[model samples]
Every structure is written in C-alpha cells, then in structure tokens.
Target: MDVDIEDILAELNTDSTAVDQSGNPFSDINNNNNASTLYNESSSYPETNLKTNATSTSIPSPQQDYNNLIILWRNERCAPELLPYPHNLMTRMLSRIQEQMERLEIISMDFLGQQHSTTTTDTTGNNPVNNNNMLPLLCMEAELERIKFVIRSFIRCRLSKIDKFSLYLRQINEENESISPLQDFLSKDEMIYYESHSEILLKLFNDTILKHLPPNMQAINDNTGTVPMIDEPDWNKFVFIKVIGPQNKIFNTDPILIKGDNGKWYYEVIIPELQERVELIIDSIYVMRYKVIKDLLMEGKVTLI
Candidate 1:
C-alpha cells in the first residue's frame, strides 16, 4: 500500500519544516526517488515504516497481565491476614492458572508453527530475520516460566501454612474447634501428626507425674476411689489422683465456666477462688491430690474446675 503523506502530516499536526504550502509533507521529493532521502534530510521528520507499524499494532502485549498475576500471587503468599477458608481460593487460583496455561500453549503453538513453516519454505536455512524473530518467542517462554515458578511457589507457601498449623487444623476439622483462622485448612498427614504428637505428650506427662507417687498410692478408677491402706501408714500419707469429665456438665461448686474465642472452655472454681483459668473438657488434664479434691474427682457426674 502507498504511504498516505497527507494523513501522516495531519496526524503530526503539520510540522512547519515537514509540511509545505501544497499540504504534502515531502513536496520536494519526486515519486521515483526513495523516501529515505527525505528522512535523512531533516532530523525533525519522524520516520515511519509500514511493516514495523503493522507488526506492533497486530500483537497485543501480555506484560500487564503477567505483572498483575505476579502481584496477586505475592500478596496471597505473604499477607499475614489469613482467609477463613483458603481451600476455595486455592481451587479458584489453580483453575485460573490451568486455563491460562492452556491458552498460552495454543497461542505459542500457532505462532511457533507459523514461524517454523515460513522459515522451512526458504531452502536457504540462513535467514537472519527469521532467526531474529526467535527473540520474541524466547521472551514469551521466559515469561511463561516465571509465571509458573511464582504459581508453584504460591502453592508451596500455602502448604507450608498447613504444615505449620497442623494441630490447629486438626482441631478444627475433627472437633469443629477452630483454634486459628487457618484451622479449617488441614491435610490428612497434618491431622494424623497432631493426634499422634498430642497422645505422646500426654502419655509422657502422665507417666512422669505417676513416677513421683508412693507405691501405695495408685490410680483409682472413678467407680472405686477407696484404695486398700498400706501397713503402718501415717496420718499424713496421701495418694495422688487424676480425673477428667465429659463436656457440658455442671460442677458441684458454682464454678464459672467460660468458653474462649477459640472454642475451648475454661473453668474458674469458687472454692479456692482461683485467680487463673483452668481448661475444661480435656480427658487427662484434671490432676488433683486425693486429700483435697478426692470426693469431687471420683464422682464422674461433676466436671473438674
């Protein structure tokens, strides 16, 4: 197509040096002469090329989209505020990445195939321009790789949270007890780890406490609190006892039971008027001496405070 000098001059607001009285930008040049002579004559005249303009107009850049994705992924990864439910967000993000990858694949295949076909048609395998076109393809490949890496990092970051807060996650999933905002997002391994770790710690604590007790003193069942007295026992002799109560039960004393924001219940006993809070509903946590809270711990009906 012939270059429209009039349209070009009008678009450029008719620069005084470029446009003459006849309205033609290059009035001095003959039609037979090359246009490069006019461009070389004046630095004020902006050079325009048909092929360069066409290529630039045809291909839309995806740089902005890539930038937006990077920012979103970074924020999602590093933000301290935890979403109440992250599974849904993960599902959405993964789906978006899959769709984007599929689209990118299609675009890359079509573009690369066209370039390859064009290059192959020329028997001379040494086309410099064809080789230069590979730069854009290389840049696209690099961008795709970057996006993929960030996405993988983002997923790993989320899984790291699941690993770090495994106990809280298990508590939420199993007992509907959300100890943290990220509690509901748990994996099977995390749940198993929490249960096993908790059981081990409780067993160790129980055994350590039991080892300090006298031989005559033993763990008495809730139904049988009366232990057989040892021979020649002094009046000061006493046994160490431990017990736990079921959930949602009232204690003998008017213990103030309060549930925390994390869904764990605490008790404040009025007898000794405890200044500190005591956790409730733990099966192995109610440790007491038989001499003090013996009768209360034996009765399964009353919850420890």
Candidate 2:
C-alpha cells in the first residue's frame, strides 16, 4: 500500500522518445505517438451529475469527492439520527469506480501482453521487473481500496442507526403513510432492511419473552403511557460541528447548554437578541446539542467533524 503516485504517473506520461525504466527507448507501449495513459482521470469521466449545485454541470475532481466522502462519513457517525442518502454523489462516484476498475483490468492485461512480446534480457541474465509500469497499478489499487473502505464505513454507520431505531421508524412509518423519516431519510434497500429486521426482532421477542407477558403488556411499541417502550434517537446528544459556510454567511443557532465533566451545566454561547440565539462565526468549531444546530447541518452550512 505504500505508493508514490506522482513518480509512477510522471513516468507513464513521458514522451515516446524518452527512455523507459528498462533503458528501452522504443518499447511496444511507447512506440505509438499517442499511447493511452493508465489513468486518464479527466477524460474518462462521464457527464457531471451532482446535486450539490444543480446548475453547475462540471465534473468535480477526485480530491473533492474524497473530501466529501470524509465529511459524510463523519456526519453520519456523529449525528444522532440517520441522514438522507446522497443519491447523485454516490451515483457519480460508483460510476467512476466501475470505470477505474475496468481500466485497471485492461492495463493489467496490457502488462502481460507487453511482457510476453519483449524477448530480451539484460547482462544480469534476469527479466526486467518493469517497476515503472507496475508502480501506477499498485498505487491506484491502494487508493481505490481506501475509497471503498470509506464508502463501506458510511453505509455501515447508516445501517447501525437503522438497527438502533427500528421500532421508532416503523411506528412513524405506520402512523403516516404519506411522509415519514423511513421514506425521506432511508434508501430503498435500507428501508427493506429495516422492515426485515423489525419483523425478525418482533418474532424473536414474541417467541421468547413477550409470549409470557399479559395481553396488555405484550405490545412492543407502547408509547401510550408517560414512559415509552420504543427507542428513538436523542436529539439532545452533543456533537462537534465546524462552520464551513462562506465568509458572508452566519448561523443564528438555538441556545444550547452543555454539562461539563464535573456535572455542572453552562452555556457555550453568550446571550444575544432574538430568542437568546447566538451567531456562529465562519471557520469556528462548536460543541452544541444536535437539535440546536440540526437546521444548519441540513442546510449544508456546517459539517460535523
């Protein structure tokens, strides 16, 4: 996984007249005037399909996607409740992943083909390893693995949230058939997973514990009384957020109080005019209750670090 991407890419992008790692000036790969680079990142991309900016139709660079993935992974983990699935971002990223995979397969095949065609050896009496050719493949594979890891972690975080609040989501879904968090926040596959998990959990409870209880107490989601049985995400949970908005933008967040390690509560923000809300400055980090800044998070003004 230790890869130097610049060196490998630079070597592959050299002129046809230049000498290669094996000291062969005219290798089959370099013979053509317009040899295809291993990674034609800009040219290989499909049309831009981003939801972040609907009117902007230019493809974002790989670094932008990488940073967005990191932000999304953190936000999904730190937020108490599940967030909406990013359909457009995911679609573009997945398409690029598939294309990169195909490109790698082709390059790997070419490596084998070119090696077979090379019928020469140096004074060392051993076949050249072609380190220059293989380096890009190794680095690219490592980077691709990293991207897949982040994506898998993001999906797993969402699944955990769904599992933790399965009954709550189901109750809300049943109460309102038109609009619910189940329909708005969850993806189609995740909704199906929630349903399957809820059914299995209910069956397990009925077969083991619930069957022994009285009829009145047998219901799993008994929110009628003061104390509710079903669990829901706590909006009071504190999260670390950083303002990522433009210089001109400012957030007037709801007043939030935090309990310190000594069990003493204090206001993180000083009092201001209108409902005691405080101004959130740009490039500043704050620890506030999730409910207090949920709107800002939803509006893309701040990111959970």
Model 2, 268: alpha-carbon shift in Å? 13
Per-model C-alpha lDDT, please? Answer: 0.39, 0.62
lDDT of 2 by residue, 1-305 (tens): 22345644742332111221111111111222222322235333333422332212334444444555567778898999888776445654676678667767777777766566564434443345655667778776777787788889999999998899888777777888786345556667887998898899889999999999988989888888789988988988889998665212212332333444675433344332235655565557888788888866765557788
Provide the lowest-lDDT 10-residue window in model 1: 20-29
Give lDDT tens digits, candidate 1, residues 71-189.
33543353332222223223333454565466447655765675677778977756777556455445545654765787677656655554444444444445543443223433344
Prediction-by-prediction clash tally:
0, 0
Highest TM-score model number: 2
> Candidate 1, TM-score vs. the true structure?
0.33
| Alpha-carbon TM-score of each model against the true structure | 0.33, 0.70
